[model samples]
Target: MTETILLTGAAGLIGRVVHHMLCERGDRVIAIDRIGGENITACDLTEVHRLYELAATVTAVVHCGAISGPMVARDNPFLIVSSNVVGTANVLELARVRKMRRVVCCSSVSAYGNTPAGLDLVPEDVPLRPTSVYGASKAAGEHLLDGYAFQHGIDGVSIRPAWVYGPGRTTECGIRTMILDAQAGRTTHFPFGCDFYRQYVHVDDVATALVLALDMEKLPRRSYTITGGSYITLAEVAQTVKRVLPQADITMGAGPDPIDDVQARFDISAAERDLGYRPYVTLEDGVCSYADWLAAQR
Candidate 1:
């Protein structure tokens, strides 16, 4: 049966990938974003009437729209509150009123805030202690979904992803910047040293997890962590870039890893068990693919 899915943030990094995957699988996708695109309907999520209208026909929703990233939230706190918080409420409310089958919200690992130093393998049961406005907003969104699921009988799950990277990534991350610089044959000097570790999941893997959550007949857990199996340092990422593009010039500043103490590798066993999520793209393979894509674009 063809199911109609209302996908918010249809033009976003993750949204675009999910949209393509859903369409390829023969699902009817109703793509919407604040910014209009060729096939995406333009609408602000906070507009409750519009959301309710859109939800009337869709069987499920994959809510990926938000004011993402810490810096964006830090700079525009008001926008974050209105969009991420209020917008999330609107989405859940639509689910409740429309009797939608399911909703899969895209969350972030930043919701864990500053984890205790050396606290490896952070689990889903860990208490959320958000360190930034963006993290706080995502935490709030998760809580709202949980409440809706329990009280209003809405079926939903929130996926907390870490440092998602892939071909279409335009964000200013160390790995992405290095790949672009290498592709352009420019010497890249990153400020962070080699020991800085961060967990990354391929954008496609994250998309797969979202689809899995949507397809599950029943969800055992309301939330799950999805990340690359292990942590890789910035130095390692740069090395992968150089290996992919031999003779590429890249250097890093000398300093201790500033974020090492705060970051924790996620234990994705719950996602594996519940959603059948397994990250297939290794860091080396993902970087090499990204570098190749970059080269083709130039």
Candidate 2:
């Protein structure tokens, strides 16, 4: 079943990878990004008329654009709100008005906020007590989608992804930055000790999950955590880098052990049963592949 997909944020990390994957699989993708290029339909999603015009022809939509980094959010709080909250609402409403078949949105693990001081394995049902404005915006977006699903009958799936990494990552992403620093023989400091568990999902796997969520015939009209697997701490991530780049010169810094709280770690059992989403790339494999790609860029 080949359906036309309207993909927002085609220039972003996950967007770029997902656009390619969708095209390769013979899906007609009308990609919209701030910048225009091959397979891209240039439009700022904040503009209501422009968004509606572009969304009119597509069968489904994958909303991935937003103010995405932790540091970026702190610097531009207003942009974060406008892009994640306002922009998301626009996309959802457009989908509703256009009568699109399904809408898949990019929620975040950030919605969980800073992990609680000590506990691990944060579940989806936990109360959403977000610490950052970014997290709040995402939680709000999920609520908007939930409302739409209940009233408008627009099938919506919210995927809360963890540390996602892959090729074509710009300088904005922390994981990509770490990979770049290691490649340059720069000392990459491991903040908050080594054993801090953090889950990582490959861009390709996330793309796959998005496609599955879009196609699943009978799925719950709720959000699901699309993590790669168990959380791998900073220490484990650094060690993986060392394996490939022996002289990476990364240093492990001392700090309080990373806290696992709120929605830090998700039980992906729901995704496994519903969407059949099992992450293929491990952290080590992803780092090695990312390191190779980084080396090519230099």
Candidate 3:
């Protein structure tokens, strides 16, 4: 099915990938980026009225614009709340007023913070326990989206993708940094996430989830969690890098990553059954892809 969609965060990693996917699949994309990029409109989503204008022309939205990650703007909780929370409200409102078809909100696994260690695959229904302000913002965004879908009678869904990593990544990713270190012939002294079981899905896999949510015949839930399908540690990630770059010398401390302590494994069966979602990028392949991409950039 073809859709005239408004895609926010058009310049970021997942946005860059999803924009191409939308256009390739014969959908009309009114792409906008807060930072401004080629063929992308520069606009801040927090400016509520600005996006409402697109509501008339677009059938649905792929809302990816936000504070992005908990690591970013760590010192500014207000920015996290405003951009992640208020920005979501604006998008939900636009969808509500226009009675748009659907809204695929780009949420985060950060929302499921403070999970019990080694807990069985965490499901979407788990009560959110956000530890940081950024995490709380994402959880709040999900609630806003869900409420809009129910009370306001608009179709909305949130994707809590695990630590997304791929090309055009503008944030600090441990995997990316380790690969970059290998490319630059530098020793890697990573601080954390060496033993912690965490998931890292590639940007391509995440873009697929966004598209599935946008084009699905029917959605049965308000949220979905996606991952690389394994609890991989930074130490394990380092080993994967060395598998590709044999000479890569990497060392990591033995502690939970300071950025987060959410160590619960995730069950993606809901996404698999509903969205027909299955990850295409394996951990080793993702490491190879990122390493090769980094090499070409230099």
Candidate 4:
């Protein structure tokens, strides 16, 4: 069934991937963004009336527009809250009024905030103790959805994704930067300890999860955490980079884990069982594929 999908942040990495994926599969995508690519409805989502107008007539919405990145989030705490929280509120409001069947929200693992020292993994029901304004904003948005779902009986799904990387992704993320730095023979700093467990899901996989949730017959509790298949330490991530580019120089730096959870692992059992969410590509496979592309860039 081909349905009209409203994709926010269509110019960003996630938005671009999801938009293109949908387009290729013969799904109708109404791209919305402030910049990047053409055929976009350029307007700030903070404006309620403007946002509602843009959201009108769409069957489903993939809400990916927000202030992402830990360092960037730290730089502008207030802006993060305003853009992510206030803007998300507007999206939810419009989705309700438009009577859209599904609104897929892009949440982050950062909503968990800094992980405690001993805890190994985190689950969805875990209390949100966000350290950054970005995380707090996402938590607030989640609460809004929870309330709206009960009140309006509108269906929604919030995907809390972890460490998404692939082609067209930003270099700030762990694995991609390491590969770039290694190839340039630049010393890359690995903050947040060597033992800090990390998960890297490809952007395509994340996009697949979003589409599945939107089209699924049933959803689980309006929220699900979509993580990559494997969890490895930062050291392992760095090692993989080294294998790809032996000349790449990298170093360790002091950076604290922003989230309170010990290991950033999401139990995908719910998503798998409910939405048939399976991440076919592993980090190694993704890195290798990405490295091949990176090699071509040089």
- TM per candidate comes to 0.94, 0.92, 0.97, 0.91
* lDDT of candidate 4 over 124-238, digit per residue (tens): 8878888767778888889888888999877988998888888777637777888777767778876565777777888888989988888897776678888887887778777
Task: Give per-residue CA lDDT, model 2, range 1-298, as digits (tens).
Answer: 7888999889888888889888988999889987767768788778889887766678899888887655565877888899899999999988988899989998888787765655556667666767788888989999999899989998898988876777766645546767788777687775655655667788878888887888899886477788878566667777777786787766666553443333446788888899989998877788788777878878
TM-score of 3: 0.97
Taken over the whole model, the C-alpha lDDT of each candidate is: 0.85, 0.79, 0.87, 0.79
Candidate 3, pairs of clashing residues: none
Better of 1 and 2 by lDDT: 1
lDDT of 2 at 150: 88
Off by over 4 Å in 2: 115-120, 172-174, 256-264
Worst 10 residues of 4 by lDDT: 254-263
Ranking by TM-score: 3, 1, 2, 4
Please give the lDDT score at residue 126 for candidate 4: 78
As a TM-score, model 1 comes out at 0.94
Give the lowest summed-lDDT range of ten residues in model 3: 47-56
The candidate that achieves the highest TM-score relative to the unseen native structure: 3
Q: Residue 197 of model 3: what lDDT?
A: 69
Alpha carbon lDDT at 43, candidate 4: 72
